[model samples]
Target: MSAVLRRSRKSPAKDGPAARRDIPPGMRPPPLEPMRNPGLSRARLLDMHRFLRLNRVLEDQLSALYRQGKIVGGLYSSLGQESISVGTACALEPGDLLAPMIRNIGSLLVRGVPPLSLFLQFLARHAAPTAGKDGTLHFDDPGRSIIGPISVLGTLIPVMTGAALAARMRGESRVALTYIGDGGTSTGDFHEGLNLAAVLGLPLVLVVENNGYAYSTPVDRQFAVDSLAERGPAYGIASESVDGTDVLAVYAATQRAAARGRGGGGPTLLECRAFRRRGHAEHDDMWYVPRDIVAAWEQRDPIDRFESFLVEQGHATKGDLRSVEENLAAELDETARQALGSPYPPPEETLRGVYAGGD
Candidate 1:
């Protein structure tokens, strides 16, 4: 009887499955909610700089791996979109969870997945945390709290929603945040996940990294909405839009939304506007991208913009920036070297981890 009572009390109707039906009529919630003054500071900005710089270092190392043929398969890169992942991860506490999309290699690093381990995972070494099942962004360290990439486009949103629901039921203060591509924003799972999160008042943040393309298809052909964040309000969730290239802006916006969720204010949708600098994957020539558009976005390089920001504000100098760049390069080189020695899972070991008890 005591156990039953405890379980019942834990999943309270006030904030769980049963309470959703009671949403009052005439609420007419706004379709978009902008985060006002994300509360910026020098310390915050410097961290953003480091994240963007680190992304550049890792991306370069990844390319070097490609050149050396260490990467068995090609890579999918988000050269210009580093801020979208790192900023959101920065706002999170140690226990907070982030479900990143394919482009969030930076998210893995920022969330405390060791750079060496990530490189090994990408290399499919036996030492990989997934034991070689996950390559790159597909799987995350459960210990680090990144739920999944699962790679099937928006499928993990529902999984994350389920996790958030369970966390809320257990009276846990944790929120589950899912990252998705602009292409994913149109999926059924995305809609269903947002609706459920809002209705339950579950702590969740759905971050849509809108980089203007769905593979080769442009955003105009992909969805009718001008802002992806607007979709959140259909289910009574708050929403915000941020400049994805501006690392500080992404950090600030995500920080606010995460704060609100942590305080039980429920889910928020953040639409981060940025551009992908390279092909969807390593071998994709990216010929479909308009050269002019790519050129314009290159001018808005987040790292360069942040470096200028730091220097203009007297926070750093050309020498300081150069030093940071050099140091990042050294670290990435070290990791890449470490990956060279890591062993691949032995062949015929493929059947391992395939079933619960080795079948």
Candidate 2:
């Protein structure tokens, strides 16, 4: 069996009776075992660290922008789930394709998307990826093999399955990876896409971010399955559940899944167990989530955990990490300034690219 499958079956029981017994009933699961280092080099580990920090910091800045009324649309904050985005994206090869959800901005950054582009996109600046036409994460960078997200949840599964099929037909060794939230997994598109991928043996990987609540609804009310990973076998695919807060574990699971897909083993369903610390969007106050759950997840903050790992393992010093953060803070400040200064699309150009050959 694959590592992902094995991990899913034998996950440690630390969170069940011992740690979280006094906590509320919903969203409680066994605590994740400490993930072994995946043997990443010092530089790569540092890069992962930077990506995790950048993901949080960038979102923090965007939240500030939203509060100041500078942003055009709803701002989604991936406050507590940075590892799921960064770790999985970092596991992909150069030619692999990934479709990022709204909260997976870290994946975009890991794929070399400049912070300025995100700021521009959110600010509705002219030079944004959508050319100021859309204010959300609806832009794609084909050059970097990053597919923009569709607004409908779970729809990207079929889109990415098709992309994987196209790559296979073209005789290219590429894998397509996409993500869905716990709520999205219940959608028809999720079932149809995963079924097709399983039947056709497409080089695809589906990451299910089971982040506690599906927009205020707890996991107990979402589905009857004890673990979402169980859904993989019903579709005849490999599946695994990992502590989404552990960046190394997430990276390792994705790496195995991607390798299996590339090696013609078809699709793998990866369930990343995490907690969404914020509301569905910035507008939400998350009144439904229990305070105890929030406090527990905050203690497992992915960035803080990874920072300690880097320092304890001698991969980086406190000063080194501090410098990385300082530099990133400076970069984001400049990027936000430039994006704010950019011009918006003129009225005449509103329909310029709306029709074919109109540009």
lDDT winner: 2
TM-score of each prediction: 0.86, 0.92
Report clashes for each candidate as comma-separated counts: 0, 1
lDDT (tens digit, per residue) of candidate 2 on 77-103: 888799999999999997899999988
- Candidate 1 displacement at residue 226 in angstroms: 1.4
Candidate 1's TM-score: 0.86
What lDDT score goes with residue 321 in model 1?
85
TM-score of 2: 0.92
Q: Which digits, one per residue and each the tens of the lDDT, describe model 1 over residues 168-198?
A: 7788888788799988888899888788778
CA error at residue 277 for candidate 2, angstroms: 0.3
lDDT of 1: 0.76
Q: Which regions of candidate 2 fall more than 4 Å away from where they truly are?
A: 1-26
